[model samples]
Target: ADGYDSGGSDEREFADAWLMRAHGHNAVDLDEIDAAEDALQETQFLLDDFAGLIDDFESQGGSARDLFEIVRQVVNNKKTEAGETN
Candidate 1:
């Protein structure tokens, strides 16, 4: 119901049609969006921590590319689960 008139079409019929279309597709949920944002933020924090670890590994003369790749994949998976695209 919140997004029912989001289209803001000047034509009444078009606005009504937009509302119908929103209902047909299920309107966006604000709570879900907030949850997704929270998840993404968490993923970012994880990435930051991994970045620090990678830097430490590299400083110790360890090849960190592989470790970085693994971390990248895990972070990507977390983002995907959060409904985000890289």
Candidate 2:
């Protein structure tokens, strides 16, 4: 969902792997491909925000980890909404 930053191949592979672990993951289980695509786009927005936080000289104002935590929350919330998490 990270905005399909990895694109379709990467996204498909991720969904396939996750489905395998979930045992018989299907279209719904993985979510509509379009939804995943949309989520990826949203994440790109967050990434841009994170990148902007970098100091003008490329120094870190803070660890990118904070942004990553937010990203994790976004994706986790979606998964929970779909009832697709442990």
Candidate 3:
């Protein structure tokens, strides 16, 4: 909220400058927004195993990145087990 606009009119001048730099003199593009949203959703799906990994790590202490690596390994195994990558 400090560096970016959250629709507050009190910072109109700063927000306008930020917008000009962000959008490069072009109108805001909905297609770009949609594509970014779609990419985020896709990444969210891949992290479906994150919750389980956190629980597992809590029970057996290890680095957080280790848990993420374990989740990535499990997901990779599952994908390869089915002979597909999704």
lDDT top scorer: 1
lDDT of 3 by residue, 26-61 (tens): 887899999999999988876767766667777787
lDDT of 1 at 14: 80
CA lDDT for candidate 3: 0.81
Across residues 2-86, which tens digit of lDDT does each residue of candidate 1 receive? 7645444467778678798878678778999999999999999999998898899989898887876887999999999999986
lDDT of each: 0.85, 0.74, 0.81
Tens digits of per-residue lDDT for model 2, 1-86: 66546656888898888887887644354467778898999999988886676543246455556767887999999999999975
Model 2 residue 3 CA deviation (Å) reads: 62
Models sorted by lDDT, best on top? 1, 3, 2
| Candidate 2, backbone clash total | 1
Query: Any runs in candidate 3 off by more than 4 Å, and if so which?
Result: 1-24, 50-86
| Residue 6, model 2, lDDT | 63
Q: Native-vs-model 1 lDDT?
A: 0.85
- TM of each candidate vs. truth: 0.45, 0.30, 0.32
Error of 3 at 69 (Å): 7.0
